[model samples]
Target: MSFPAELSAAAQAVEARLAAAIQALPDSRVRAAMAHGIHGGKGLRGYLVLESAALHDVPREAALNAAAAIEAMHAYSLVHDDLPAMDDDDLRRGRPTAHIAFDEATAILAGDALQALAFELCAQPEQPQAAALTLKLAQAAGAAGMVLGQALDIAAETAATPLSLQQITALQNGKTGALFNWACTAGPLMADADPAPLAAYAKALGLAFQITDDILDTEGNAETAGKRLQKDAEAGKATFVSLLGLEAARARAQDLITEACDALAPYGKKAESLRSAARFVISRDK
Candidate 1:
């Protein structure tokens, strides 16, 4: 399905900005790896960032910078996640994984460079308070948040047995939800929004998105999912479906989506796009 017109337009603008930023980088193997990871995909995380920004009345140009920053972090994570040390996948977004497209060493370097670029993009002086808010994004996507989540995920997969439902959810929250949370929170954070409500909305939507992702991984196809299918089960990774059964897991995802929408209600009609995006998260096939 297509995103809302505003979201789609914002995504296009963000993609253009990101491409320009990447092109300006020094030409090298690392830049090539970064480009490979960033060029494909639907730009879903970036869309989320822009949509959330619109919800808070952020200007389109400012929102585009935030979108680019979030996408950079996401692309970096995907490159690292596909490495041999991580998921060891051979394909991503219908193309060779970064480690396969480039050597593992180059892929690793690319991920690192992308991480730096994410912060750099955020720190750019164009937007007021961009530097401070970009640092916040770094902390959210770095060792304390997404990185820690990934460490737990890798351990869960390699352990003698799978993790419990709670453990798995926690891991997914950190690895996947942290970035989603950052995407939503970054816009509000940059705008100096009311901290309590902004964070509540971001956290709820982040978890909701991840639970829906678990559902899709179980039932989605490699072709449409843009990655391997049932790979979580093959890896013996604990998931909501594995613990709660498919139907129950689906129900829980729906509940989370409802909670996410509720959290945004206080934002009133301004949050319509964000509300729609939340529904799309749960309803998405991929």
Candidate 2:
């Protein structure tokens, strides 16, 4: 299957920006570790930032900083999530995870430093909307968003009953959807334009992404996934595939992808890359 050239270009641009941003950090083992964590990925969130910014005619100077910042933040999340206390993974991106490559202390510090750098980059945007952008990022990654979702996930393990569908949706809306929302609407937000359409797109795309993740967990191999798979089942976790069954979950993801594309109807041809991204969410192997 042919992937869209536009998305590939956007991903490359974001990857370069992320690398440059990390290279500018002050020299230290932690800095090196931070760079290591940021290296290599599909770079979907950062690509969304750049593409959305382009749609709104936001300059590269402003968009690059925001794009790099989001990737930095995402890298931090993965580093921490792979810790012994969290997802407890030893592999990521087909290599040893941060904690495994470096010591636990170094990995912890890498995550902390990368997270700080994310805000620093956001603060330096050429546009005057730096403050607003930073605020949204904080809200998305903080206790009100991704952290809240993770906390809910951890707590759910101890609950006597499994989380309901509604409960899971609410949790994932923060954990996964919030970043997508920020990425998809970043250009509009920076330009002080309406974000309703992109927000609607992200809501559907993010859910589809998570549902596919659940499906992958059930049927994917760790080698292709670059990390453990089927662990959700091993942990007896509630997931879309577990709740809705395999075919149902796949159908639901397809429906959501269609919905996400529909949300971009106003943008027409300008949103074709974003539409491709929505499809990629479900089709990715890792």
Q: Which residue runs of candidate 1 sit more than 4 Å off their true CA positions?
A: 1-7
lDDT of candidates 1 onward, in order = 0.80, 0.87
lDDT of 1 at 107: 95
Best by lDDT: 2
**Which residue pairs collide in model 2, if any?**
none
For candidate 1, the C-alpha RMSD (Å) to the true structure equals: 1.8
Scored by TM-score, the top model is 2
Candidate 2 off by > 4 Å: 1-5
Q: How far out, in Å, is residue 112 in model 2? A: 1.0
Q: Residues 190-283, candidate 2, lDDT per residue (tens digit)?
A: 9999999999999999999999989888998889888888887888878888889899999999999999999999999998888888998999
